[model samples]
Target chain A: MTTRTVAASKSGKLLNKLFPYLLLAPAFILVIVLNYIPIGESVLRSLYDWRGGSRATFVGLANFKELFQDMAFHISMKNMIKLLVFQLVVILTVPLLAAEYIFRLKNHPVLQNAFRVLFVLPMVVPRIVTVLIWQFIYDGDVGLLNGILKGLGLVSLARPWLDDPRLALYAIMFVGFPWVSGVATLIYLAGLENVESTVWDSCELDGARGLRRVFAIDIPLIFAQLRTMAVLTVIEVIGGYMFVDILVLTGGGPGWATMVPGLNLYENAFKFSRMGYACAMGLTLSLIALFITLLNMSLFGKKVDE
Target chain B: MRIRREDLIRLLVLGFLAVLTIAPFVITLFISFKTEAQFIRNPFGLSLPLHWSNYATAWAEVRKYLFNSIFACSIACVGALTTATLAAYAFARFSFWLDKFLFYVLMFLIMLPPIMSLVPRFLMVKRLGLLNTYGGLILPFMSGSQVTAMFILRSFFSGINESIFDAAQLDGASEGQILVRIVLPLSAPVLWTLAIMNIMTSWNNILWPLITLSSRELYPVTVGLMFFQGQYAIQRGPLMAGYIISSIPLVLLFMFASKSFIRGLSSGAVKM
Candidate 1:
């Protein structure tokens, strides 16, 4: 009402308007600089032949051209395609089935909690430790897999798992045996839990039993989870070098059987000092991810109920 | 207490699946306690003369890296939790022009695989003279987990009854005061949740440090253990022992917080 109070109220309004930006600037700014800029910077860096700061010549797309011709790159792309196809099929079905079983435990909260904990348990183990344990299990002399095989009197079948290129990549895949019952299971189970009991009762009245119930009722209900799991699995494979496993287990060989582009990028940038080339690989990977994300957005759409 | 035949069958099948999932870890634990000679000779079965000393040697080998892990993860937890809490409070409470846009931008970053940005980030750090230091390791981790923490914390902060803030404002509390004295005090559970998560993640992180840090001095327990394994590949007993030691902290954390962790993840998914 008074002049001083009015001046104070005006300043307070300005402060109220500015306060959110002040609060957001710290972390929002950090995330932008660290995450968003790097993507654009990677594209820019890919255009140059930056040989470890010794010589950075802007060669434009030449690195990408070289990437296409590079045999290792080709091998990595092939293996990635193989991994993606294999993961897509397995990741979708196995977890959903696991969730279906877990869903049946709706009557038993304690049992359900215990199993849920157990399912996501392995996730908490540092990925390195889990990968290394599998490494030991694949060791030639005293590895558990071979040891178990021999104990079962399959002496001829027991061989150096990691030592064989053909088996090494596949061996790594099976490390988390029945890997289905992890976070994916939890997601699907949550989706299943959200379904109306009336829906199930009507299906039961109609005698929509077993697989028919699942195919007709369950799958459609958990469709969002299915799509999400697919996108997440593909993106993770493309980005998660799990190459550390290769580094410890087989080092990408008997040959380049397990080589993935993610690892290739690491080796080029750090080991070989081919920063520009690695940047090119990084950009290609981002573009692939972006393509998949856009495709998922279109397929899954912006709404959940839909 | 009578079980239906169908329920009994489900229980049995679930138990079997659980065994199949857990057998390897139990077997590895059994192996870690064995002498190397015993492991090689009596490979699949438990034997006499358990070699518990393998843990001692493994612990000694990795103790330095353990400290480094603790240091880096703690720094990361503090830095990340602080930034995320502030940003999350703003997102939850404020209606700036860019709030929705910034929120989606953060969401977009969430879907991006960090490895896409790996090269440029490494270069950015190196150019800024942070490579091979804790700063390089901690900075990326802070960014990597920011969106997730923000998402979780924003939901929590937004759920706080608005009357508390209104009352606090009437009592002459500033925005900073409301955040620190009011919102943050009520947010301990979520803050601790994010703290534990960030610690677990940064502790397990390997790829970024693997690329950035060339020196052993900066190696967190994860990368250091990898080097230790590579160096002593033939020492299976010690390596297995080391793996067990390294995993114990995280496994213990998981056992305690699996409920909250699963809830957080599932809720986050539903929100998305």
Candidate 2:
């Protein structure tokens, strides 16, 4: 009986050691098969000349070479750069301003919560629906923007907002008007809440009033949150599928005016069956994203240390 | 007895911004209830004879896609949360040989943009014969979301009182029992938040489903709305109604679990 009990305890110890691995197996298997393998395959396939299904002949660097010379790709890159600048600016300003406003009303908890809920309410709407609603708003005839402009007696300025190539890209950028993103505002609010009451007391004692107080205390206190938002905005603008928006809104435009790199990549792979070229574009875009992210981290890391 | 000038000015500014933020949605709702003639007469304002039939027409078109979206998103959310929770528990509670290595591997994936693997993943899914099936959608979503879910869950699980876990272990409870009974119960709020975030992302996704599913029956609401818009380009009332109908599930989710929804949105910022 003693021997049997000892043997049972030994096996139980073995089982205890194996348990964590057993738990990890499911997620690991799925991640390996789905994410890691595909990423490896993407890197390999980008070097080959293949139409997705047929035998891929290795043509080293040719696809990348072609991508560099592609005029449409150049246009998309320029449009993306323009978009990135605009998005970063909007993200830094609008949501921070809104969060600061909400943060100032901390004494009035009821009003603070009300504003928080209202600001986040729009985010529950599906993004596609948001884009489509904007599509209708930018419609040539019987659209809200045009109707409002005409209502205000600015008839000359009420031309088809989306149909005009010069205005289409800007219109797409302006989809969520006033651009107070819920996520950004919430993040800033959380950051603002983290500031010690003692810090606030010192600022008040120093007589840092109005914009002086904001510039001196509020912005610096939320620098970490600002960095986070900046990085997120970069990833979003770079890696997001403007393909869907462009497809729904302009189909890359009245002549490649709004042709973003993501849409261009989609068109190459699926629409034109240039899968290899698309892979190269995807690789390039991802590298650019990775580079920018690292740059952002290092830059902010230095500032925070200082 | 009276509002301060500064406070009043702040209130006006915030109120004005709130109106601007919600104006598009409010306008969509009004237009959804208007007749085509009514919309044409006054595109930006409320009109008479609330046309409820537009919703019926829109519902007829949108119901299938909504069903597909709910079915797929729920599966993906639950699948991701379950797998991620188990993995996170192991990472949080145990110090095994491969623990640090595996954690780093998963963390590295968070930096790799999903768009990089788009083309190859599509090809692989096609080769596996999962293109139009629900598996193609659910599996990728589950895999893609696990890293973030695991990241969040592991941190939350780690912060729990270690003594409770030890006490449960000393009671001769197996690892599974300890997890299900102690860890999971302790971390319900975080799990709830993660589940809601997963569902919201799956619901909003368009590009993947659009590429994978060719059949009209398999289309999610996002893809369905695209085709719906194309077909109903001129029918403003029903088109606007379709947009609103597509949004109702998420809006309803927000209404019912506003606290969890808000928490989930903010928790996402904690990823970095």
Candidate 3:
């Protein structure tokens, strides 16, 4: 080959080596537009306090200072933390137990498949549908729950479930119960399925059964799945409360008992028309969420399936 | 042989679990046909009239919302699938210094909750002149690291043998040509799976649309249904109708594609 052709071939080889990077560029650019730039803008806007529109005054940390004095804000934060704790416990236990149970049924393929589908069905259903269905169930007067209780002559136990400040959060919590274990089940089931049958046979020979097998064999095998579910559940609890706002159906009222940061942020930005201050609140909430997620990562990120 | 007591207990447990799981959905299906008054009064009972027209009325009222939802969701799904596939393919088969760093960063992005970016995202969408536009709704969803889709696609893509690439090279196939002609044809199952997932993500997404879309005309089903929630003193009849209508397309889609979607969700469970 002549020098010209050889040079041309070498250049082509270089171009071929870079092709994947070139292909990835479009995705990277979109990420900046979608995630990076907006996050940067949120930080910038967090320092300002202005109404909706082209006008905002940079107030630095004053909005945050005002945040401390706001009782509603404090209640929202406390409620969020409580939710974060309660959800972690409930979501974690149900999934771990169910996943272990399902995994142990390797001999019953049909039942396993049916259970998987049934549990995951709720996740596929939209939140709006879920909220609407539960609202009827939570309805003060004519709800099936209340009706069933009264018909059974347990009138004292039946009350407006969503309206009671003490019980409203729990009403919101139940909305998540349907599909809460799905991801955990999926993860742990996968992990459990991958375990060599010989190991399980040995465990059986050791006379492990039910709760014993679960504690001794099953939990260790799927500790990674447990970690994954824990992190995701926390994120879901913090970011996922938006679904609860719909079910509570109070319009962030009944004395702000059902209000979470998301609804509060939405109201502040759109409903209250305090766009700049909302941005600040949104920024604060975002930081809090990010911190929680990061905390989860630092705690559990390294122990992934790898 | 006598059935063991343990086996009987397992059956009982399974039965109870199934009832718990399926009851809510059965209740929802029943309620879809019930009126607001009927729903409030007897949510569990059979509808007196079995008003299916509520579906029709709900559809008409929320038609724009449905259209907007379909439009936004379709665009986001298509965009996410296309971009994620390309990125995933590159990450799966190719190696370079930047690849590992980019992959790790993407993983970090996945860990960051969507709410963390809500305000910033809204501002960016507004500034880009995409507010209330399909592009704005699509971009955040389609491009926001889409970690789950990328993970699924990457795992599937990596499973293909290296010999295929060598064989394609011997045939004088370009990289893009191999991706399009060979890899894509073989990866149809996963591609379709991710497509369903992307569709679901876009369809169920409410928070992003809540902030970005200003006009009623731009409202998707999730936001559109909110209109009926308060506008007529909680018109539960039309609202239930609206829920039924919005849900029909999704349910139909899932009924046909659920097997693959279930496989996909479970397939990535190992990674998650």
Index of the highest-DockQ prediction: 2
In candidate 1, list every pair of residues with a backbone clash: none
lDDT of candidate 2?
Answer: 0.86
i-RMS for every candidate: 2.4, 2.8, 2.7
The deviation in Å at residue B144 for candidate 1 is: 1.4
Better of 2 and 3 by TM-score: 2
Per model, how much of the real contact set is kept? 0.64, 0.70, 0.42
Give residue A182's error in model 3 in angstroms: 3.2
Q: Rank by TM-score, highest first.
A: 2, 1, 3
Across B93-185, the per-residue lDDT of candidate 1 in tens digits comes to: 988897888888877776677888787787778888998999988988898887778877888888899999899989999888988898888
Rounded to one decimal, what is candidate 1's iRMSD? 2.4
Task: Please report how far candidate 3 places residue B213 from its true position, in Å.
Answer: 2.1
TM-score comparison, 1 vs 2, better candidate: 2
TM-score of 3: 0.90
Q: What is the lDDT of residue A136 in candidate 2?
A: 80
Best by lDDT: 2
Q: Give the per-residue lDDT digits (tens) of candidate 3, residues B18-113.
A: 677667667666776877778777767677788878778777788888888888888888778788888888899889867888987666666556
Candidate 1's TM-score on the B chain:
0.90
Q: In candidate 2, list every pair of residues with a backbone clash.
A: none
Model 3, range A1-306, lDDT digits (tens) per residue? 699999998999899788888878778888877777766776677778866577888888888888778788888888777777877787668766666666656667787787777766666666676776677777887676787899899999999998898888777767645443355666667777778889889988989888878888888886777777777766666665454354336655567777777777777776787766666676677666668766766776573324
DockQ for candidate 3, please give it.
0.49
